[model samples]
Target chain A: MIRLERRKEPSTFWRVANPFLAVILTMLAGGMMFVALGKDPVTAIRLIFFDPIFSAQFGSYSRPQLLIKSAPLILIAVGLAIGFKANIWNIGAEGQYIMGALFGAGVALAFFPLQGWYIFPLMILAGAFGGFLWAMIPAILKTRFNTNEILVSLLLVYVAERILAAMALGLMRNPDQPGFPGSRDLRRYESAHNAELIAGTGLHWGVVAALVAVIFAYVMMTRHMLGFHVRLAGQAPRAARFAGVAPARLVVICLGIAGALAGLAGMFEVSGPGGQVRIEFAVGYGFTAIIVAFLGRLHPIGIVLAGLLLGLTYIGGELAQMMLGLPSASIQVFQGMLLFFLLALDFQTNYRIRLREEVRR
Target chain B: MILGSINPAVLLAALMVAATPILLAAIGELVVEKSGVLNLGVEGMMIIGAVTGFVIAVNTSSALVGFIGAALGGMVLSLLFALLTQVLMTNHVASGLALTLFGLGLSALIGQGYVGVTPPRTPKLDLGWLSEIPFLGRALFSHDIMVYLTIALVAGVWLFLSHTRAGMILRAVGENHDAAHALGYHVKRVRTLAIMFGGACAGLGGAYLSLIRVPQWTEGMTVGAGWIALALVVFASWRPWRAMAGAYLFGGVVVLQLNLQAAGVRIPVEYLSMSPYLITIMVLAIISSGKARGSLNAPGSLNRPFHASN
Candidate 1:
């Protein structure tokens, strides 16, 4: 028989090791799934986990794509980690991201045919503000009415999706192409474009913002009174209240920061890589960021590393889809498996397994 | 007045059809929550059931077998959750979310080949004399077996929770697991069974969508029904009969919105489509805020992980 003994202190070794262990487990399980799909599991696994970063065939092209993909994930995850620290769940980052894109794109479209150096910067602020505004719904509702944030925030994602469809079909539709339901390609709009800061390197303002967010989060978490209160609130709500942490204020602050950062990610994405406010504008970055937060163990620097790793999978999953005729959903299943293993292995950090004999009473 | 173009009988019938999926899913969740476990994976389990039921029904040419397959499929997925949260000691909320992501991906993969393929038809019950009963016949008796089964299940659940010895024990576990455990009850076992039953019901709900409602396997087809069902539990205040009422009410909104869109009632299609979700949020706020006593109905150990150390 096996018994689990709770540890007084979580094992630091296991905390560091479990994520890597989870990754390995996900690979083995994912390979088996590929085999079930009637494909060569070995090649599938190699392509998804290794080929993108190591192979000569796909590495160079996929390398830059990795940073592009990870940027938004890292940025959004940084904000989510803060709210999660305070035991506040804001799973509606996807909705916030959508609203941010709409707001940012609205600015550019309103300034159509105009050229100004300040336009892009103004759009960035608009994007952040849009996300903050969307997030404030749940924040205000939760603070005022004592509603559940998770359901309220998540419900808004569907609402946001509908609004996005409306914009694509009506408000934001490109007049230049009458029948096409999309906005003017912002990439070709020189004045409002989020062009590469450096040629061929995929370095953009979004990457820089992600890095700044990382550094800022690291500083705030390590050296701020609010950070202390956040941790205290998550660990002990009653104690935190006694220590003068206003739960309502913290809810607003955490949701605001998360909303702004997610909005910024959405803004940078629309301005740079995405370049259009279409029906499919909001991908699953907001939801994926939740996984990124946990895989990184809710730490700032760890989120960066975790984001890059998931980013690699995104590029590699695409590559695998192209090369092996693998279905795109396989990658989603792969990410889900990765999360499962991560959660399952987390047991190791807080408890130790011991083999023992059962004694009958 | 704007609803003049719509037929009340047809709309009421459509409401029953639309409400079945959420009603079935919510009733099962009611049991799970009553047993003190919160599984936010109703969406995931439903989709898995949808795909599995579709696949099995298509291959076997039997809708009944398809539903059984869907329930089994959902049970298997919830077992994974039980393993994670119960045996492996993972966080319930995180595990539930992971289950959803995994379920969506897995279902898509399984459903790739089955897309656009038609499954066998599910037949409605023939209540001979009741079939000719005016408007009530079309709105109520016209549904297939699952509709009556769902209502029966709701009544069954109410009886099970309030009348039976097992029901009392389950509620006891939900109200306070530590006390239940001290009283020599198997809290984990009771919870696991409740979770499995929930999965089966959610799966049946999904199969109902694929087999009777939309009657097709579309990717991400359940939309936000699962989440809405989760909210329904709160709206019903954890009472089974109230959950049925809440489901029908929400379903009425959906049918009304669709009818309005079809009637071209001047409202944008997008706004009409978004009304259900917005209404849900409004209802949640009102219910949660107005009845301070309502919070007491939530199981005391709803989301808490339980471990028995001998």
Candidate 2:
């Protein structure tokens, strides 16, 4: 019987190419899923993948949304990738996003009826700071008390959700829409709105910040000492410690960066598209961003492309939902399938599939 | 006078029912972790179980059949994890996350038709004369079969880990897969068994929710129970009995907060609702200092992949 053997070390070519192969497999599987759901799989697939870029009906409207959706995802994923690369798991970005919205929107509401241009910047700063502080709970707990960051971060999401519900229903509820469980529309205000600088093209400040982050992250990974430390810590904890890569500092930096980016994503989202803070404002972006980061292979540019691809699916999934009568869940299942196959294929990159040897009894 | 209003008897019954699901899930997860696999897919698996149990029980009107269906649903989902992490040697963290994501998606897809439909009530089992003994009766005897099963499961699991040879071998594999492999133990097989067991327990927990607690199918109904199970294991510090203690403590906190809300206690609903998670973190902080983190007994290779390469 023919058997494949694992490489002592995976090749660079295989390592980089694995994600692309995984995407292709996911597409094939996704097409099959669409077909199973009784839709014209080809038309659905085209609408999702090809039509967004070239089809006349949607290309104009869809193209701008690409950047709009990708901005927050890229921002959040980039920060998460940094922590993952450093072996620090921050599973509470959803909570950070909620907290960021709470803090940023709180600022705007406090300064309501006053149109100072500087207030927007202040809110942005506070948003980032708020997220950073929430992340610190787990980071500090991990560094000081040896608490599990995974559990700590994960549990905080529930806490944050409760806080969001409270604010929406109680303190931050719009006085005008009495009894409604939602916050004031920050976007309606001149000082708080995060509108596109380039109008219909969807080029907003958040997108610019994301691109800047990608470039800076690329440089950091390729050249900087801190980036080197992050990679080394994940690859070899012993070597990292010996090389004087302080675990405490890395934890704080990774958590802080991730929190800030999630915060920015939250702020931009609330001010731009969502327009108001509500109990369900997050819509699982934080969790979905994890998939984006992995699909990008944790590279900054890769994440941009991955983010756009995922964003297209989001738009396509909604379209399919409306047009084909496909349940909204099919989209989530498709995304889950992508992660499933992506993780399954990661094995081929590292180890070749081989049968075990029989031992003499 | 205050005692007259508290209704300690009813409160005990509610607490027992509330704790059963978490206890079942946390105990299963504790075993899986003790075998050195951190399965974070319990919530997803439990949700699957909840829907599956509801469907089966509603159709068949047999609570036993519902639980059986739940265990089957959970085990099947867990087999995916077993295949990926145990057989393919994929990263446990990523695979566990994928399991949950897939479970969530699949459950939501399958359960869309069942929403707004209530399942048949789980039949409560009476312990004959034992249930007539005042406070003790309500506290321990007047519950569904699953609650007793859950408590018995805790004791059984505790004994299995502390006494049995198979349990010892499983622990050995978790502690050092290579050593276990060298000693002719099928480390993968052992771990796979642990994963299935965990999945079944998670399934029972899920079934308890839909078939007993909520009595209806709802999308994302288990909410964050899986995460709570994960935390409860940590709180228990990986011990089976400690898992029981941790689950009861969490359940009490949840029930108390709900009671406070019902009583119109002046606290904000948000603060009251947030109390459980916040209290868990505080408890984590108190017990987490320096030494007691994750039950000082967590296996060295808890989340590592084992490659049986020559």
Candidate 3:
């Protein structure tokens, strides 16, 4: 029988190879799922994995969408990766995202018809602050009252959805369209609009922010003292304490950063692609970012690549939905499978499977 | 009579029904936590159970078979979690989250064709004389079998954990897996079984929602009931009876808020709708703050991954 033997140190080769292996495993499993669903597995796989980027008909439209879809994922994942490294879980990024959109849009609407450069920057600040404020609830509770941040944050997501619904239906409803439950289109508001920076490339301010965040995170993880503390805290909590690393302070900082970034992602999405604060404004980007962070191995550069890969699936999944009569939920299942495989494969890095004779058992 | 518009007996009965699902899930989770494993995928498992139960009930026209199928469905999904967290020794939090995501997607896929369809009705227990007794009967005795089963389950869990040797062993493993392992107990096996029990309970609770509460299939239903159940376990301080009390308290709040909305009370509908979650946060804070040093009654080895080494 095969037994797992612990490694003295994590294997570098498997650390890199396992993600690829997980992806291949996901593809095979996802193909089987498609077969079970009564679809041609090969065609479904090709459509989801290949046709989005390779097909001449859809490639042009989808290639740009890749950036649009990935920008929020990368931005949110970068911040989340930092917190996850510190063993602080902020499961309420979705709430923070909603609050951020609400805050940013509130500013835009409050200063309606205002055409100043400062308005957009002010909205950006409000967006980050909104997310930061929302996140502080769990952070303060965890720090001061010893409450579990994970459950608190997760519960807040539902609360945030309610607030989002309220805003759409009452507070931020477009007056011109009395019956409609949405805010005025931000795209038409030139000053507040997070317009594409380059034509037909899907490069918006959000994408630029995502890139900068990736670079910043890479630098911090490699060079900064706080990043070292974060890693130390996760690896050895006692050692971290002995080194004078304040758990409460780390909790606050990590949750704060994650909230702000997720909020920023929400703000950018609303101003650009989403265009308005509507009842259906949330698109599960916050939740999906968690997968992106894990898929990236919680590393900055890896997150960028992971985000893009996931973005491709989003585009491809849509294409599949339109052409092959596949349900949109399949993509979600596919992503879940990817994460499952990745986690299951992670066992390889810490242990080696070896066949040994029955010794003492 | 208290509120002029709301009937006290009706409110009480509604509260009991409202609390049953979370109560069942919470009791199950309490056991899982007591065994020192935190399975955060209750939401996923519950939804799987909900859809499976609904589909089966609709097809076979029997609520009993639907409930069983739902439990099996949830258990099967949890086995994947058990495999990952137990055998592979993956991070519990991540694995649980993955299970939820996978469950959600899979349930939605399975339930695609079943949406808008009514499930077979769950029969209410016929209590003849008992159900006819004044206001108390309507408030308590007039529920379906599952509600009584859930209450009995809580009592059974309490009895099992306190008096049974196997339960003692399970608790011992949860409190200190290494120590339990040293004492010749299979910590992993115990936890794996405990996790499956949690899954099965969550499934039954979910089936109650689809087959009895709503009696129809809907995508992404049970919005945050699983999370609320999780909170209930914490509020209960890992005690079975306390979990039931917490569930009833939460259920009362939910029913009261809905009643207020129906009566056109002053509070906005949105705020009223969000009250349960906000109240949960407050309750959590209060419960957590009560203990200064560490978590209140939490299993010492909760959320820790165990790998046997010789």
Candidate 4:
């Protein structure tokens, strides 16, 4: 029988290898699921894992969609990863995302029928501020009252959803479309629209922001004192305290940054691909970003790649659903499996397995 | 006359029904936390239980079997968690989050064909003569057997945690796993069992939602009930009786808000829809700020993964 033995230092090999192994395992498991659902597992798996990138028919269209989807995910996850590094959980980025969209849309709507360059920049600032303010509720509560951030952040998501619905139905509804429960299509407004920076490519302000965030995060994580404190805080709280890291301040700053980034993602999506504020505007990006954060091993650069990979799954999962008649829920299951296997395999990084003869006393 | 027409007995009955799922889940989580394991996958497990119960109940035409299936499904899911956190010694928070996502997806996959299908109705308790009591009977005694079971489970949990030797060991493990291990207790084993028990209760809660409350299968019908249950456990300060009370209070809010919406009260439906979560958070903030010792009651090893080795 094999037994796991503790290791003095975590294995660097497995630390890098586990995510790759988990991906393979998820494919095997997901393929079986597809087979059970009466679909050709090979074709189904191909569509999900490979076709979006390689298939001639889908590749041209799907390629652009991948970047479009990955931008917000990467942006949100970058912020989340930083906070998670500090052992601060900001599970309510989804709520902050919604509020950001609302705030950005509010600014755009306020300047309806007007043309100005300042409007977009102003909306971006407002959107980030909106998310920041929303995140502060949990941060302040946690710092002052010592409440759990996880529950508070998550609960705020439901509240934010309700507010989003209210805006779609009431305050933010497009005046021209008298009966529709959606705000004006920001895509149609020239000054307010977050249009593509490059023709035929999916390059937009959001994509630029995501790249900038990634580079900034990479630099901060590698070279900054705050980053060292965050890593120190997570690894050893008492040591961090002795080293003069104020836990409360770190909590607020980490959460604030995460919230702002998530808000920017929301604002970008609303102006870019999402086009307008609607009841269903907050698609599960905030939630999905959690997976991105972890799969990237909380590394900024790794997060970008993970975001794109997950984005492929989203596009490919949809393709499989349409072409192979697979259930949409299968994708969610597939994503969950990735995390499960990664966590399970993470055991190997910290321990070694050995086979030993039965010990006879 | 108008106030009288808004019958308190009916409102109380609805409140109990609303509370049962959360109460069951919270009490189960209380035990898990008491054993030094925190499983945040309650929502995932509950939804899985819901779908499993719904599918089984629809196919077998038996609510009892449905609940069994739900419990099994939840336990099975929790076992994955046990393996990850207990055996592999992974991060509890990450593993729990993964479990929730997995449960939601798995339930949806299993529930694909069962969408819009009605579940076999769970029978309300028939206490013959006792049912004839004017107000109390209808409010308290008229619920489906799960409601009574939930109440009994709370009492059982309270007794188990406070009085029994096994309960003491579990609490000791939660308080300080290293010390408990030094005393020759199997910390991992105790935690695994606690996680499974929590999973089973969350399953029952999910089953109750599908078979008794909503009485139908719907994707994401559990919504955020599992999260609410998690919050309730904290609001209760990990106490069984207090958990039940928190559940009832939350249930009361839910029932009241729905009633207000149905009665066409002047408040926006969106605000009413969000009231329960907002109220829970507000209450949580208030309770947390009141006393430092209150939060300290949380088991020391609550979210920490334990390994026999250093």
Model 2, chain B only, scores a TM-score of: 0.96
User: What DockQ, on C-alphas, does every prediction get?
Assistant: 0.84, 0.73, 0.83, 0.81
Worst 10 residues of 1 chain B by lDDT: B287-296
In candidate 2, which residue ranges exceed 4 Å CA deviation? A1-5, A354-361, B1-4, B291-294
lDDT of 3 by residue, B1-310 (tens): 4369888889999999999989988888889899899999999999999999888888999999999999998889889999999999899999988988888888889999998887777889999999899999999989999999999999999999999999999999999999999999999999999999999999998998888887777877888899899988888889899889999899899999999898888777998999999999999998989564326589999998888886
Poorest lDDT segment (10 consecutive residues) of candidate 4 chain A? A352-361
* Model 2: per-residue Cα lDDT over B1-310, one tens digit each: 3334666777877888888898888999888988889998898899988888888887898878999999999989998999889766677877787788778887888788888876777778878999999898977788888888898899999899889999899889889989999999998889999999999999989999998887788888887888889888877877888888888888888887777777777879888988888888878876777655455767877888887766
Better of 1 and 2 by DockQ: 1
| Candidate number with greatest DockQ | 1
Interface RMSD of each: 1.0, 1.4, 0.9, 1.1
Q: Give each model's whole-structure lDDT.
A: 0.91, 0.85, 0.91, 0.91
Residue A347 displacement (Å), model 3: 0.8
Residue range with the least summed lDDT across 10 consecutive positions in model 4 chain B: B1-10
Model 1 Cα lDDT, one tens digit per residue, A1-361:
8888777899999999999999999999998998999999999988977888789988888877888899999999999999999989998899999998889999999998899998899999999999999999999999988888989999999999999999988898999997888898999898888888987767899999999999999888889998898899999999999999999999999999999999999988988899898898877999889899999999999999999999888888899899999999999899899999999999988888877754343
Please give, for residues A182-282, the per-residue lDDT of candidate 3 as tens digits: 99999999999999899988999889989999999998898999999999999999999999999999999999999999899989989999999997999
Give me the runs in candidate 1 sitting further than 4 Å from their true place. A357-361, B290-292
